[model samples]
Target chain A: MVKQKGILYDSTMCVGCGECYSACKKQNKLPETNSDFLKDHLSANTYTVVEQHGDLYARKMCMHCAEPTCASVCPVKAFEKTKEGAVIYDAEKCIGCRYCMQACPHQIPRYEWSQVSPRVRKCVLCQNRISKGLPTACSEACPTGATICGDLDDLKIEAKKRLSEGSDKYYQHIYGLDEAGGGSVLILASVPFEKLGYTPNLPKQPMPQLTNRVMEKIPTVATVGGLFLGSMYWLTKRKNEIAREEKEAKFKRNEVK
Target chain B: MKNSNASKLSFWKIVAAVIMICGLYSSYIRFTKGLGASTHLSDSIPWGLWIGFDFLGVGLAAAGFTIAVMVHVFNIHKFEPIVRPAILTAYIGYTLVVLLLIIDLGRPQNFWHPLVMWNLHSVMFEITWCVICYSAILTLEFAPVVLEKYNLTAPIKILRKISIPVVILGVIFSTLHQSSFGSLYLIVPGRLYPLWYSTLLPVNFYISCIAAGLSMIIFESYLNARAFNLGLRLDILSGLAKIVLYVLIIGFLVRITDMIITGKTPFLFLPRTETYMFYAEVIVGTFIPVYLLSQAKYRKSRMWLYVISIFTLSGFVLNRINVAVTGLVASSKTSYFPSFDEISITMMLVVLGMWAFKLVSTKFPVFVELENLKEEKLPEDSREMILSE
Candidate 1:
């Protein structure tokens, strides 16, 4: 397997500038959703947005989890996680069931609701650029190196080093490192991740595994259930037949006597 | 007599015409525009009335397998007479579900993708396969009678030999998908309100549906009795209602015990709008029906039994809606009510199903016992007699 690529975002260093947001739009060829990036949220049109929580600015986008719930729950297998660790989607394969939307722990995918033939739209993590050995548009546009893109392994060591070096300056935990079975995107925040608008209390175990545990039992349930019903039918039918036959024989014996 | 029959038919025809026109218009809008224009759904809340109703449709249809297993599997011939009608109701229910799914889908044309593409991990995939499988079995189970209509003894013979195994398969498929509907929500525990969420969801769904489905059969029987003038034995309905009582007790115990075990008692949270729905579902749906049906007087009376079944069926409706829509409102952060198009289309489907049921029951031999059909009646003769009536 190829080494997975990941994005490292340092919330302590972001400057509330809208450069990364605008760069994302340009890279994805999406129209400007809002004039002010601070007010913008993730939408069908907007892939990434910079949110300002008091003085701190945090970027919100797809987490690109190691085992994505979207990929697992899709009946058509529309969502795929590339070797680069970016979870991507194929519009052609989608029947637009939106189970992915309901199933996503991060709740990242957005539907193109206006179009008659709508497709689920979300960040592809600049998969094309990553394939070409280049950084994502957001990271490239980040002036302060607040957001960096590289191999996930290297990013993890770097994130841990930053945590140790600036122990007093960070929250002492890397967001997304183990949350929902650890996404490729890692975050270093000055405050708790939840305070910065990230979802809280997600299990370290993967979200899909919870669903898979039940799904994997289907074949066995079907087999056992079928066998039980068949046997019940046989036993009941045979018992009723025996009762009928015995009654007929007794009536014949009484008549002969 | 002929004059009254003609006028009555015309009256219903007019009513059907009005519903169909309005429903077709709403459906037109749903197709031309998109789900965004037709529904109150948004990015935050992707599912709404259609998905909820799908759950209700599939849940109520559980009677097909219940009746089938009772007659074909358990050798309970008392329920054998109502099996055809139950199967017909189920076939219509599933067809309506498929239609609604198409209307609700963003890419309706790509609906067939699920047939070819496989994701064994998805509950949706499992449900899809099961529904398709069950619908086919329903057709097979109902086919011999239709073949008997035309005196086609050869195909009827083949259907007879395979009938037992086919019914067993139908029961198996029904059990899987009915519970899988509840399993659909298991993945979204964090998003769904905890009161309705649990590891025992599939079990809860299965048992509750069994109760609701038997109630549906009773409810349908009363309507059939009135419309077709068929005197279904009171004892059969009583027998079925008794089964419903036992099911209700089991279902209530499972649900209440699960709630206690999961520590999601409504007492934990202050009462809200959803809390009222929970009360309506549990009390009106389960408690009142169970209390009334357990008594011999209530169970024996046709009027009391009819009303009790309605109460139980409504409770089932409320529960499905609560699970699909109301429970997620807190997480969605957006209140939702169905759009005019959504409401109209849903109404249209119900009316359409009722109309189809009438047409089929009248044209074919749906009520075998009441018609005195010991041996299959000649199709040509029965057709004339039925039409004259």
Candidate 2:
């Protein structure tokens, strides 16, 4: 069985050096979007960035949820959650409906709006490197070891160890540990995650499960609704036919008189 | 006015011709320049005017199923006169939605991908399939009108025999997709404003669409009478107007109760554009229409009925816009208004829809089968119910 890969980002250790940002660009062959990385936002070209929050820094990229909303909402099934734990996209299969952009709780997906044939874009979590037993581009390029890669179980244990060891030094919560039903990428921050510009208060339920719950009932609705209408059609047709027959009988009796 | 048809057609024809030319040019630029250059859309605002217009079209087009159920399923034969026009409006409305979707898609060439690609979990996938199925059902429903004109009795007989089943399928498909359109936004609770977002969104969409669909039928019937020089069926329309009133009350109650029960009424008092727009939608779409419709004179009068329908339609448009665009503003931190290219294309499509309606009404027996003419008498209490104004 393929072991699930993961990344644990210790934002306190991040020096805002932006080595991972450049590494991601080099690895993905994306064009240079900004000379200063701090001002850069996620875009079709730039998949990840180091954001400075007062005294600390964090990297913004795909959360790689265990069960992703993009994969759920896409009509064409263009997004897939791979065994390696990366949610990958196939532009070849994309129809550019942008439901992924609308549905992503993190608002992470960007679009190639300038192209005639645009594709939704986001970080792939370095699926190619991880599949070959290599760490992700960002984790490999972290000079200070802020971003570390390992099996998801090992990473969770490691994140818990650091949080327990330095209770005063870190916030009590792991940002992505159970957010929207948790993702492979977890963050340990010195400040409250929301203060560090993280999306907070997400429900523990996986986002897709919210929509799927209603979707599961559709078949019953269709079948039951069809039966009800069919029964009504027959019932109403019979009633109308009887009324017509009574009116005709009266007309014939009057004519005979 | 119906007798002055040639002059009326000429003026509207010139206006439509001008809009069509501009729309064609805009479409060319949109395809060539791509979304980034052609519209004000961005990563934060992936949807804009086109999507809002789509909601309007799909919502209004719902008359197809509503009238079909009334005549064919329930066997309320009094509504048989307006069934053809309602279906034609629906056919045109769905066609407009497809055209707009193609124009708005980043990869227009891949429009058919949704057919073979199945994502049962996706609301969009469900809506797409429903629209496709409903469109086919609509075609079958409308076929007899065209077939009768060609004196094809054999096919018409088959259509007549299968009419009840076709109407049933059409209603089921319409209910699924119309509600699902609201479900499309359920996944974006954080982005959509609290005033518009609720777990009952699908229910709200379904109930409100019934109101809009019924209003659209009223609007079209009156317009058809004015266009074709036919006598107005005040009894039938007033009966429809009463249903619209009850639906408006139910829709209003659902929305208000949901907001209060979910503790979203606080968001209602916020000083945001969304709040204002929500008020606008409720007032124009719900409150005023309900108020005007409740009055005997307004419900029965030809001019008042037309005004009330327009108000209800405008309110629906506002609610959709608020749901699609305005609600996301506070979270997105960016406001969006459609660009000229977007405006022109939408206008062009609407004009094209009108032209199609005109052509089909003139060419086919769209309202020729007035088989149910027992509706000449108005209700005794409906004072000032002018037959044709």
Q: Write the per-residue lDDT of candidate 1 for residues A1-257, one digit (tens) a residue.
A: 77899999999999988888999999999998888889988999999989999998899999999999899889999999999999999989899889999989888899988888999999998999998889999999999999999999999999999999999999999999998899899999999988999888888999888777777787898899888888888898788777777878999999999
In the range B105-206, model 2's lDDT, one tens digit per residue, is: 888888888899889999989988999999899999999889988999999999888887788889989999999999998887778888988878888999
Candidate lDDT (C-alpha), each: 0.87, 0.88
Worst 10 residues of 1 chain B by lDDT: B380-389
In model 2 chain A, the worst 10-residue window by lDDT is A208-217
Report the lDDT of model 1 for residue B267. 49
RMSD to truth, every model: 4.8, 3.2
Candidate 2 to truth, TM: 0.95
Q: For each candidate, report its DockQ versus the true two-chain complex.
A: 0.58, 0.63
> TM-score (0 to 1) for chain A, all models?
0.97, 0.97
